[model samples]
Target: MESDKIETESLLENLCVGLPTIALKADIPTPKWNTLNPYFGAEDITEIVDWPEFNYNTIIHRYGGILNSKKIDCVDFSAPWMHTEVWHKSQLDTRLDELVRPHIIRTLRAAFEELEPQTQQLNLNPVTFGHGTTAITIGLFWPDTSFTTVAEGYAQGKNRAPGVLGISPKWSSEWRHSKFSNDQHHFQYNQTLAELNFYMDGHGARCGYVLTDAELVVVKRLDTNGRLAVSAPIPWKTGGNGQLSVRLGLWYLGMLAAEEENWAL
Candidate 1:
């Protein structure tokens, strides 16, 4: 299993190394994309990855609208969810349904189309999103994941201890002292972490995300240890390379979702 993991990681990186060229070759339409470096804000997440394959330095100048921050303008800035921070908890579902989920789904669809079945060696399915309530967004990957599990997992979290983003469950305040070590005080200690973990577990998903409208966090289940490789809150409305960082990151995550268990941890 250890040797397989090593080979899988190597293959994963090698396979992903050509994604930029693949994305570049996909002439979906016109000159509508560009490149940017990924921002790594989470210090606790080990094996930090810089997706240089998707960088324009290697491939063509743009990523062919699949990762275009300026070209594909699906976000409605006038909507309430359009702001940097989604202040209204009730409308969180609207943002996911109307904006975030659709964009990422398209990204995955575009990504999957670029790969051959022999290259991917996995059956891809229609990616979608749904949940019982709007407290969190749940991804429905290939083979159709259940929404009840999402609701139940989220309910378990709420039942254990109510938490508001940034206030509880190891947000910015706790992150100041958060450590990478697997101890009692690891990132998985709180109720919110439990919710995120169980939510992915229910879907049998290895790749997931936590998008609070203010900032985005990428969560990857590493192993059976219950510890996740989660990114720090990256401002999605605008990032270091403008909005491209979050989109590219999310696109990479979408690729991981399609790969499912085949993806490297």
Candidate 2:
């Protein structure tokens, strides 16, 4: 259990590394949040928090003075990150959690702290399920619940990352079908076939993203061949859509990852 506890200093260190300017600020008063993190951040699946931000709004911004006292560019979310708003609002509703929760569990189970592009989603499976005459594709669906805000998604498990992944319906179906078949060989024996869905819960991770100073990458979880498909890094700070600040994108991602439990199913 001690090993399972993410060291606060290290977790803070990881978060601070390449961290966007404002991922930690939210409604909570900074002093109050800093006090609670080391405890709640340790909770596992047993705690079963229905909402993820309850912990993070209280945790993420405690990285000390630089993020605390300093003001970076006087960031504005509604203006620049307005693109961070959820798209395709109808897809993965509350109805699919049972089907999707497994994906989130897999991510938690397979979680490690690596921030490089792991692989690519060449298979692009699309999952189409029917509810009345309306049909939704898993990869194309939206996370109406997972991430209401980006800050919540970024604080997701502090595993650190780079890239956005959009899983196709076929890939989604494949992930559902594979469902851990021969999964043991993946982690223990270095034979990975799972696409590593990170913090997937409600929005099915459709719009999930990862970023750093140089690049903005959309990360998709692919199940067809156990490889990750990372979108080409779109420069974040000084390229087209430069207004898409790393802070806002991360905040958007924080919400996606926050919907961790609120996500998959």
Top candidate, metric lDDT: 1
**149-185 in candidate 2: lDDT tens per residue?**
2222332322222222221211121222244544422
Error of 1 at 175 (Å): 2.5
Worst 10 residues of 1 by lDDT: 15-24
In order of appearance, the predictions have TM-scores of 0.47, 0.24
- Runs with alpha carbons beyond 4 Å of true place in candidate 1: 1-88, 113-126, 129-170, 173-189, 239-244, 260-265
Regions of model 2 farther than 4 Å from truth? 1-213, 224-227, 239-242, 260-265
Q: What overall lDDT, based on C-alpha atoms, would model 1 receive against the true structure?
A: 0.37
Cα deviation of 164, candidate 2, in Å: 12
Cα lDDT tens digits for candidate 1, 46-130: 3422223433232224333333322222333234434333324334545455544455444444444454353335643323233
Superposed Cα deviation of residue 186, candidate 1 (Å)? 8.6
Per-residue error for 9 in candidate 1, Å, reads 33
lDDT of each: 0.37, 0.28
